[model samples]
Target: MPENTPLLSVRDLSKTYQAASGPVEAIGSITFDVRPGELVCIVGPSGCGKTTLLKCLAGLLAPTSGSVTLDGAEVREPPKKMALVFQEYGRSLYPWLTVRDNVALPLKARGVPKAERQALVERAVEEVGLGHAMTTYPWQLSGGMQQRVAIARAVAYQPEILVMDEPFAAVDAQTRADLEDLVRRVWKDLGVTVLFVTHDIDESVYLGERVLVLSSSPTFVQEDLTVDLPAERDQLTTRALPRFTELRTHVYEQIQRAKRGEAVAATP
Candidate 1:
């Protein structure tokens, strides 16, 4: 319960799959902790099992060894206090449902009362700047707007931790920048802990308080680097800072090293 204690703890977590040939280890071992209200971004090479690691943390997949704990309890199944937003925004949203209904679905499943659910839905829609699109269906919106709907759904759930796996990858450059700022605004406003996984180095630097770099294939923690930039960041001004360039360049080098198999030992 202490502020310093980790809200989510991952200890020597690993995952291996049984195949026809042999056991293929996706995650060698990864260890990290996310404190309350911290926004942490994870980056690694394409095949470094970042998604696999996130699955274990989300309790959607069991690890081969070690553990993922939320608030001191081992995560066995998807935690009720946690929410996930995936990369494929179009697939996640129900084409049949209106934006309001899609955002309210989770609350409804959780048995939230109709009045409270409506209030939460409206507030979340407005928060994401989608107040006018409440009655529109997912199929009717642009790609970026649909992603906003996905984010609104997560925000409306009032999760303690929001796990986003490449949530902005599908949008265009301008939209991606807008969504990045939106995330920061929402994070600051709600004080929700965030664990974001992205392959983009710049995105990691822009969004995270700490960026955890993962090693190649049999993945491990290559580096856990902190972002020392000011809290209030704009895409143009923040990215142009000399410190930003240095941090991003450093992360880029670490990832390149990871690809070349220069893995540092992860903390046990």
Candidate 2:
């Protein structure tokens, strides 16, 4: 791979499930790339295989056809260079473990040294503003704080890419907004490539440098809209701005089209 090549790439990726009812295709052929340090969001209608794509990218589920590559190597299993955060924070974090312990588990799995793991865990928790809750268990924290601990754990792993699967869907609106901002801050500060999947058009537009819209079931890429807003996005001011509104409207329209099973143009 060239130095400037994407840290992760997907080509003709598809997933199918065999049920007693017969074969069910979840995702159809789709291809895209996530360049180093880029924040890309995938959005589509419910049951459009957004989560399936994330699973394929994370190597949690093998695609029925096509391929996913990480750092120019075909991803056959979970890559050490990638970390995933799911929608259910409660299920994702271990209730029996302290926040600090949960955050440090990935490092431990990777066999990182004790001193280095401690430092990384501390830094990640501090970055996510969960330093005060480090000793608390997941059950003791609010929904938002639990999610932050989950994110802090992913970050502590120091993965080259961070994949989030509708991570804010379980939180209240206010907490969701704060978590979105927190994700952006961490993405910028860490300079890690991010692949986020969400059903919320506004959320995708607000968070992504490029928002990818997928077609309905047996999904494929429908559109990829580059968010042309300034790098520093303020939730209030940015959302109220003309450009942000325009971008959000574009993604919203595309998603509406997808829900109707209409063909939409891909990003230029």
Candidate 3:
């Protein structure tokens, strides 16, 4: 695939649900594109349809207007080449299955041979730093380790694009920081196009190559801001950088502005 070509394209997409009261609009014609090998984060105020937009992109929900395409093909249903990591690690993993089994399930589902699935599960477990706990059950491991298993499962899928909807939201602050670094390393080493949705301004600046800010209720794309930070980001050095502070501040103010219904600058 061409580097300049978009791996995922979301064109004028919006979602409305038929509710008892009437039609409740979640997103209002939002548009954006994520190029191959890019890590983009979508940030917005609470209840701003971030999840709705993500669901549309994931092909788990049909949009009321516009479209979502992956690799030039329209996304009508969940694409096999894509993998999703949700926030709830506890419910994501099976309590009865060992970590290795949990990580191997996706490959098995895809009809991969037992030998190939074992190899993939081993690699993914090592990649997520969970090799030591592979034999343990989900209930036996810590929250962070369980999430690592979840991540390992996604990695083992060998997806072209990985979409995460607040995957680390439930972890502790320190664990969250560690997982953030882990994601960057995984993205770099695997070269997977990542679309990470988060509510944290600092995290958005820390992780994204570009941060797409969404407007409040009846959401739309308010801004498409490039992060412009070094590709090799660290929790300490990157967060301490002057540019990092500036970008986070800019995204922060944009969320505040969106809450207040003020006009937001498109891109900067």
Top lDDT prediction, candidate number: 1
C-alpha lDDT of all candidate models, in order: 0.94, 0.91, 0.90
Which clashing pairs does model 3 show?
none
Per residue, candidate 3 scores C-alpha lDDT tens digits across 1-268 of 8788999999889899999999999887788889999999999998998888888888899999999989989999999989999888899898989999998888888999999899999999999998898888999988888888888999999999999989988889999999999999999999998999999889988999999999997888899999899888988999999998889999999999999989553542
Compute the lDDT of residue 35 as modeled in candidate 3.
96
TM-score of each: 0.98, 0.97, 0.97
TM-score of 3: 0.97
Greater-lDDT candidate between 1 and 3? 1
Writing each residue's lDDT as its tens digit, candidate 1 over 1-268 gives 7899999999989999999999999999888999999999999989899889989999999999999999888999999989999999999999999999999999999999999999999999999999999999999999999999999999999999999999988889999999999999999999999999999999999999999999998988989999999999999999999999999999999999999897778545
Shift of residue 234 alpha carbon in model 1, Å: 0.6
lDDT of 2 at 151: 94
